[model samples]
Every structure is written in C-alpha cells, then in structure tokens.
Target: MKVYGLTGGIGSGKSTASRMFRELGAEVLDADVIAREVVEPGTPGLAAVAERFPGVLGPDGRLDRTRLGARIFGDPAERAALNGLLHPRIRERFLEQAQALADAGVTRLLYDVPLLIESGLHETMAGVVLVWVPRDVQRERLMHRDGLDAAAAEARLAAQLPLDAKRAHAHWVVDNSGGLESTRAQVRDVWNQLRARD
Candidate 1:
C-alpha cells in the first residue's frame, strides 16, 4: 500500500485537498478525526484527560474541546502533556484503519495529519504532500474562518513548522493560495503523479 502523508498549516485548505484525493480514488485516513474519536465520552483517553485537566468536560459528559484548546495552546507543557496522552492512541487507531483498508485492496492511502512535520511522521509515509499558502494569507484566512483576532491567529500559526520549511521536506507541494479551481487542478496533477509513483 502506498501511504502518503498530507499536511498543511491551519486554513491552508488541507481538508479540501484531502477531499479531492478521495474523489480521485484515494483512501484518506484523517488524524484529526481519529484524535476526536479517541477522546470521546467513555473512552480511556477522555477519562485520562478529565483526570489530568479537570473542568474540561461539558455538562453533557462530553469533552469540551474549545476550553481544552484554550488551556493547552498557550502552554507548551500542557500541550505536550495532551499530545503525549492522545497521539499514541490515535496512532494505534490509524494503524488499525490502514490495515483494514489494505485488506480491502486499497492501493493508495492519504493520511491527513495537520502536524505531520512537527510530529516527525513524514518518515513513516511513502511520500508527503504539502498544501501550502503564504503566511499572510494563512493568517487572514485563519482569523476569518475561526473568528480569531490577528494576534491569536499569529500565535496559532507560530505553533507549527512554517509552510516553507515543510515544503522542502515534501515529495509533492500543492499551492492552495488561489481559487478552488486552481487547487483542484493541482490536486488532480498530484494525484496522477502519485498513481504513477513519481
């Protein structure tokens, strides 16, 4: 199976590219989805998190993700603790899903992970695809998309490896700073190259 790592900065249209890959007949294993799954109510991850970070649960017995994000994003120690707790379980789930897909005869798989570079997961993939945008565009789009101020957007962007740095590490790079049609065209081109094992 060809497992490709797809990553990008926030608001860089990584999700959009992932959907395009699926449309082009690639199985996409999304880390963000797996991360949420591992932390759902009644799960061991949620229980561990609730123990470590009290008051991060909602009245309905579910994890309050926004509150949790606010608590961890500003503190490296807290963020590291959260990642330590969740990343392993998320990896386990990803492996299970990948095995299932491989068993089902899927040849192409894209692992959509936002922090693929920061987490050093690119080494595990057959190739890496970077969906890229300029820092200014990314910050503006993030602020508008997430209802954050400029400073908050900048902080969030600063938390990850820069897009230019990630580009150097990628096997493929898709520029998503333009319109959807352009991005779609780039995705199609990349998909062809991937299928060709380029």
Candidate 2:
C-alpha cells in the first residue's frame, strides 16, 4: 500500500484536495477528524484538556472548542501545551485507522494532516502532496473563509511554516491558485502519478 501525506497551509484548499482524492478512490485518514474523536466529552483527551484549561467546557459538559480556540490562538505556551496533550493520542488513532484500512485491503491511502510538516510526519510518508497557493491568495481565502481581518489572518498564517518553505520539502505539489476545476485537474494528475508509482 502507498501511504501519502496531504498537507497545506490554512485556506490553501487541502480539504478540497482530500475530497477529490476520496472521489478518486483513495482511503483518506483525516487527522482533524480523529483529533476531534479522541477528545470527545468522555475521553481522557477531553478530561485532560478540561483540567488544563478550566471553563473550556460548556454547560452540556462538552468541550467548548471556540472558547478553547480563543484561549490558545497566538499564545505559544498554551498552544504548545494543548498540542503536547493531543498529538500523541491523535497519532495513535491514525495508526489504528491505517491498520484497519490496510487489513480491509485498502492500498491507496492518504493521510490528510494539516500539520503534517510541523508534526514531522512528512519523512514517514511514502510521498508528501502539498497543496500550494500564493501567500496573497492564502491570506485572502483565510479572511473570506473564516471572517477574519487582515491582522488576525496574518497571525494565523504566522503560526505555521511558510508555504514556500513547505513547498521545498514536498514530493508532489498541487498548485491550487486557480479555479476549482484547475485544482481538480492537478489532483487527477497526481492521482494518476501515485497509482502508476504503486
């Protein structure tokens, strides 16, 4: 089985690429989904988070994601603490899901991890597929997508490694600066390449 890592900066359309890959018959293990699953109301992940940051739970006893996000965004120490707690569990879940998929005879698999590069998983992948966009486009999309002002969007972008830096490390680059169909075409080309390599 060929396991590829799909990643991109926020608003660079990694999610769209993931969906296109799914349509192309690849089994995708999305880290964000697994992260949320691991931290559900009764899980140890949530318990730890609640303990670390009190008042992050809602009246229904579930993690208030917005509140927690507000508390950690741009706060390096707090953000690191949260990652220290969640990353290990998320990695474990990814391994479990990948094994199940492999057992079920899945060969072409993609791990859609937003922080693939930051988390140092790129070296572990068969190949890393980076969805690329210009910094201006990324900033525009972030503001439009998340309703953030320029300064706020810039801060979010500053949190991750620059797109140019990540591009240098990618095994495959899918340029997503154009229209949706253009991005889809790039995905199709990469899909063909991946299948051929396997």
Candidate 3:
C-alpha cells in the first residue's frame, strides 16, 4: 500500500481536497480528526492535558479548544509547549491507525496532515500531495473563514511552510487557485493516474 501524505498550508484547500479524495474512493485519514479524537472526554490524553494546563478544560471536562487556541496562537513559547505535549500522543495514534489500515488491506491511503512539512513527516510517505493557492487568495480565505484580523491571519500563515515551498516538495501539486470545479477536475485526473499504479 502506498501512503500518500496530503498536506498544505492553512487555507490552502486541504479540507476540500480531502473530501475529493474520499469521493474518489481513496481511504483517507485526517490527522486533525485523530488529534481531536485522542483527547475526547475520558481519554488518557484528556487527563494528561488537564494535568498540564489546569482550568483549560470546560465545566463539562472537555478541553476548551477555543480558549487554548487564544492562549497559544500568538505566543511562540506557548505554542511550542502545546505542541511538545500533544505531538507525541498524536503521532502514536497516527502510527497505530495507519498500521491497522495497512493490515486491513487498504492499498492507496491518503493521510491528510497539515503539519507534514514542519513536522518532517514527508519522509514517511511514499509520495506527497500538496494543495496550493496563491498567497493573496489564502490570506483572503483565512480572514473571512476564521474571522482573523490581517495581522493574525498573516501570522497564522507564517507559522507554516510556504505554500510554494510545499508545492515544490510535493510529488503531486493540486493548484486550488481556480474555482472548485477546476480543482476537482485536477484532483480527479490525479486520482486516475494514482489508481493506475500498484
């Protein structure tokens, strides 16, 4: 089975590409979904989180992600601290799930991981799929979608590897600057080429 790590910067249309991959009949794993799952309600991840950051949990005992995001986003040290605490747990879950899917005979798996470049996880993949858009478009999307001020949105973008760099690193690049239909057509063409392989 080939492990294709699908990655892109924030607002690069990774989410949309992931859905298109699923629609094209590829088994897809989302790192963000797995990250959230590993820390749900009564899990060990939740307990660890509580121990690390007191009162960050909601009254209902769930992690207040919005609060956490606010606390971490602009602060480099805080962001590093959070990543240090979460990356190990998240990586473990990813490995376990990937292996299980391999065991179950999934041949062409797509792991949608936004941190692929920064995390140095590109080496783990058989190939990489990077979704990309123009920098201006990405900034505009993030502002409207996440309601971030220009500076904050720019900071968020700066936190990740540049989209053009990601595209250069990718085995396949899906340019999403055009309309959704154009992007989907490109994705479909790529899927056909991928499916033709072993």
Model 3 pairs whose backbones collide: none
Candidate 2 per-residue lDDT, tens place, 46-163, comes to: 9999999999999998889999999999899999999999999999988998999999998878999998998899999999999999999999999999999999999999999988
Number of the candidate with higher lDDT, 2 or 3? 2
What's model 1's overall lDDT? 0.94
Runs of candidate 3 exceeding 4 Å displacement: none
- Model 1's C-alpha root-mean-square deviation from the true structure amounts to 1.1
Residue range 148-195, candidate 1, lDDT tens digits = 999999999999989999998899999999999999999999999988
For model 1, the stretches where C-alpha displacement exceeds 4 angstroms are none
Please report how far candidate 3 places residue 56 from its true position, in Å: 0.9
> Each prediction's Cα lDDT score?
0.94, 0.93, 0.88
Q: Candidates' TM-scores?
A: 0.97, 0.97, 0.94
**Candidate 3: 10-residue stretch with minimal lDDT:** 47-56
Model 2 scores a TM of 0.97
